[model samples]
Target: MTKKLRNAPAYIFLTIFAVFSVFPLYFMMVSATNTSQEVLGSKLLPGTNLLENFNNLVAQQDLGSALYHSAVNAILTTVLSLIFCSFAGYGFEIYHSKGKDRLMAVLLLAMMIPFAATMIPLFQLFAQNGLINSTAAVILPTISTPFLILLFRQASRNFPHEILEAARLDGLSEIAIFARIYLPTMRATYAAAAVITFMAAWNNFLWPKVILVDSAYQTMPMLISNFSSGYVTDYGALMLAVLIASLPAMVIFLVLQRAFAEGITGAIK
Candidate 1:
């Protein structure tokens, strides 16, 4: 009884924190079901306007194309990032040469340079190549990040070298060993990377906005931005759009959260 009493304050604090953390999401959902006026009035409960908001959103925006574009860009970026970064990471750790270490240091240094600093040059290069407004332009800059490479490299440190030797002795090619052994062994790491890469790619707005000049290639973020852009913004429909846009990343994280935790903690197996 005494111990329970001692922990009561802590529990109360935690409950309050949890409520505060969840309230934004709850408000977003509730606002989605409200009229624009009601949403502006900060109505906290679900209302009867969800269907109306959906109708308005559909009428006003090209939701389908936005969803398709965002999905393709994010999925491609995540897939390519995983493949390229994982290979780079595996090589860096397994090979372990002084030259590679210096190269890695250079890559790590590159991460310090903000994306904003490089956007103009990237835009110019893409323009010169006639690649502006293309999916390739949207995806190319993000498919291999220093951060992802570092993540995979760190994860690779936990992989067993003896397994590699055994696989090699068994006449497996390097690619075969990576495909058959290292990949399965690092499932958690991959899950974590996939979640991270997918979320980043999905939420990316600035680069895509700059690169995809054509409105037809608008992504979900751009669509959401357009919703909130005008003199007469439909707050309810805007909330609904945001709610929909947020779903994929949330789902990916929830599904991989356990593995994400394990991978972040460098847990092998």
Candidate 2:
């Protein structure tokens, strides 16, 4: 009884925080089912306009193509990033050397350079190569992020070198060792990386906006921008589109929440 009383304040604070965090999502969902006036009026109750809003969004926009482009960009980025970043991280930590440490420092320094400074050069290069408005253009710039590399490098510190050595002595190739041993051992870390990478790729806007010059290559973020860009925006359809756009990232994070927590804390298991 006494312990429960002592913990009451913490529980109360947590409950309040959770409500605050969740309220926006709830409001978004509610607004998706309401008209523009009701939404502006801040109606908290769910309305009957969900199907109408969805139909209007689909009829007015190429929602299917946007979803496809976003999914392709996000999945390819996440998979490629995991493979490359994990390899870089594994090599850096497992084969520790002075040269590698220096290189890692340089890479970290590169992170400090703002993307805005590099965007113009990147655009010029891509234009010279005639790769504008392609999925490759969108996916290329993001495949191996410094942050992901740093994340994997930090996680690799917890990997057991004994297993690596034993596998090598047993005549396992380096690739085989990584594939069979290190990969399996770092499942939680990989899940965390996937969640982060997928969310970033899915929500990426500025680069995609600059690179994907064609309307056919539009992503969900771009679609949302189009929906809200007009002088007379349909708030119901806009909210519905936002709800749909938000679902993928939300589902991925919720599914991987536990692994994400564990991985962030460097829990080996």
Candidate 3:
């Protein structure tokens, strides 16, 4: 009876979790399919207006342009971060100087300092350097986040030192070994970082809002923010826009599907 009761709890919690997780997705789809009026009336059943909502969303926003800006920025941020962070991680791990060790301590401290604390001073510095309202202002400030650096460093700890030593044995330069040998074997690491970086850049809100002043430069999040209004909020169209905005991150995770499992598997190994 006790063993049966233990099994009963697992089934109950799993059923509850599945419903909670799936309900939002179902509602989003239902909302997207209903007319704005039907949505306002709180209809839960899926309607026939999915395409219509999509059409309305396309006509309402410059979906192409907004997605393009988002894609470009996200790609840029991901690529630069992968290269720089991986290199920094490799350097800190491989070199092991006292100064670099101290810098790692500082990096940890920097992560503890809230972004809100630095926002005013960062804004002033960017303005003085003519970086405000520029893509650089958004992309550059975030390149060396402590979390990412530490993530890469942890992965580096698992790397086989013999490989690096062998490269040096063969007289290969450090940079060349990092580029050619280390990176190739560490594809899983890079793939894991890519998903996180892409999602971060895509959904980044506050700093982008501060720096990207032009309407053309606004992200999907900002677009969603302005979609709702005082008198007439088009819930169906808003849901459609959100669905579209969520696609890239979804697609990226789908592409790096293996990396999702890699972390868990690597941990056990």
Candidate 4:
């Protein structure tokens, strides 16, 4: 009981923080169900206009297309990042040499530099490569995130090196060892990386906005932005778009959360 009392403050702080995080989601749901007028009327309660808002949002010019592009970009980015980051991380960790260690240091340093400083150069490079105004432009830069590599490296540290030796005893080559042994054995690490990578790709805004100039290439985030403008912004429609944009990520997290939670635990053994 005395120990529990000592931890009471931590529990209180966590409860407060949880409420703070949840309030906005509640607010968004309520706001999405009401009209711009009702929202401005300062009602935080849900209304019956949810269906109407959905209709209006879907009715927005090229909304379905925008949502499709955003979904596609996110899926492609996450998939590629998982494959590349996982391989690179496992390789760098399991196959350490002075040269590769220096290369890893370079990659870590690159993560320190803000993408904003490189935006112009990145855009120019994409243009030069004929990738601008395409999904490739949006995905190419994001698919190789340094942050994801670090995450995988940390998880890989938990793997048993003896497992590698055992696999080698079975006459497995380096590539075969990773594919048949390491990858299959590290499901949790993959899950955690996938969740983070998927969320990052889905929520990315600046690069998508910069390169995807046309409505065909625009995402749900851009759609929400356009909806938030001018004399009479449809708060309900805007909220719906925001709501829609958040769903894919939510679904992903909810579905994979168990795997994500377990992934790190398994890796440590």
Candidate 5:
């Protein structure tokens, strides 16, 4: 009874914070269900115009194509990032060559440099390669992020060395050991990386906006930007689009949330 009383305040605080966090999303859904005029009127209750709002959004914007582009960017970037980042992380952890530590320190420092500084150079390189206004351009540069590499490296340190030595003694090649052993053991870390990479790629705006010149190649963030830039904005349509755009990220988070927690704990443990 005494312990429950002591913990009551913390639970109350958490409950309040959770409500505060969820209210905006709840209001967004309510606004999405209303007409533009109704949304502007500041009504808190849900209305019955969701279908109409969505239809208007579809009719006005190239939303379908934008969704396709976003999907491709997110999925491709996530998969490729996981592969290369994990490989680099594993190699850095296991190999330990001379000067490799210095190189890694430099890479970590590179992550601190603002991405805006590198944009012009990246654009020039992509343009030279005829990748301007292409989905490949969006996906290529994000394949090896420093942060994900760090995550994998931390997780790799916890990997069982006894198992690795056993595999080596059994005539397993390094690549085979990595594929059959390390990858499976780090499933939680990989799932966490997948969620993070997908969200970053999906919500990426500034780089995609600068690189993708053609409206046909625009992603969901670009579409939302177009909607909000107009003089007379359609709040209902905008809200609906936001709700739809957020769903994939939410779904990914929900699916991998448990693994994400496990991954973090496993790395630090």
Candidate 6:
């Protein structure tokens, strides 16, 4: 009884925190299912207007194209980043040199510069090249992230050099070894990278907003922003759009959750 009493405060704090964190998500889901009129009320329960809300949002503005563009940008960026960053990471770790190390240090330092500072130059360069208002603009800037390269470098340290030597002795080329051997061994790391890259690409707003001036090329996030704008807002439709927009990131995380956890553990260890 005394021990239980001692732990009561801790349990109470945890429970309260959990409720606070979960309530907003619960409210979003509930609101997404309610009518515009019903959403204005102070009800915590879900209503039977999910289809209606979705239809209303679709009717007012087409999210289908936005979703597709977002997917393309996110998937392409994730895949390319994994390839480039992983290759760079593996090279840096396996073939270290003082000059290369200094160059890498410079690149790491470059990451410290805020994106806002670089945005104007990036926009000017793209505009000069006639790439403004293109989805390529959204994707090109994110093709390789320095943080991901660092992640890959750290993870590559755990790889066995003996396996690499054995493959070389067997006359396997460097490209073959990396693709057939190194990549297979780093599944967890890649999974984690995929989750992070996909989430960032999916949720990226400022760069996309500034670069993509055409309404035709607007992404899901842009659509959500516009929904909240205009004199009157459709609360239920906006909530539904948010829920839909959030689904891809949530699904990607859930699918790769196990590997994601394992990757973090491996990186830490």
Clashes by residue pair, model 4: 188-263
Candidate 6 structure, TM-score to reference:
0.95
Q: Candidate 2 lDDT, tens digit per residue, 1-269?
A: 99999999999999999999999999999999999889989999999999999999999899999999999999999999999999999999999999999999999999999999999999999999999998888999999888888888889998989998899999999999999999999898999999999999999999999999998999999999988999988899999999999999999999999999988788332
Order of models, best lDDT first: 1, 2, 5, 6, 4, 3
**Each prediction's TM-score against the native?**
0.98, 0.97, 0.91, 0.91, 0.97, 0.95
- Error at 93, model 6, angstroms: 0.4
Off-target runs (Cα >4 Å) in candidate 1 are 267-269
Give the lDDT of residue 172 in candidate 4: 92
Which ten contiguous residues of candidate 1 have the minimum total lDDT? 260-269
Q: What is the lDDT of residue 98 in candidate 1?
A: 97
Q: Would you give me the overall lDDT of model 6?
A: 0.91
Candidate 2 or 1, higher lDDT: 1
Over 1-269, each residue of candidate 6 has an lDDT whose tens digit, in order, gives 99999999999999999999989888899999998777888568989989988888998787999999899999999999999999999999889789878978988999999999999999999999999888789999998888988888888889999999999999999999999999999999999999999999999999999999988888999999988887988889999999999989999999999999888777666
How far out, in Å, is residue 52 in model 4?
Answer: 1.6
> Candidate 1 — what's its lDDT?
0.95
lDDT of 3 by residue, 30-131 (tens): 888999998889899989999888887777777787787788778899999989998988888877789998999999998889888988898889999998
Which residue pairs clash within candidate 5?
none
Q: Pairs clashing in candidate 3?
A: none
Output the TM-score of candidate 3: 0.91
By TM-score, is 1 or 3 better?
1
Model 5: per-residue Cα lDDT at residue 198: 96
Candidate 1 has a TM-score of 0.98
| Models, CA RMSD each | 1.3, 1.4, 2.3, 2.3, 1.2, 1.6
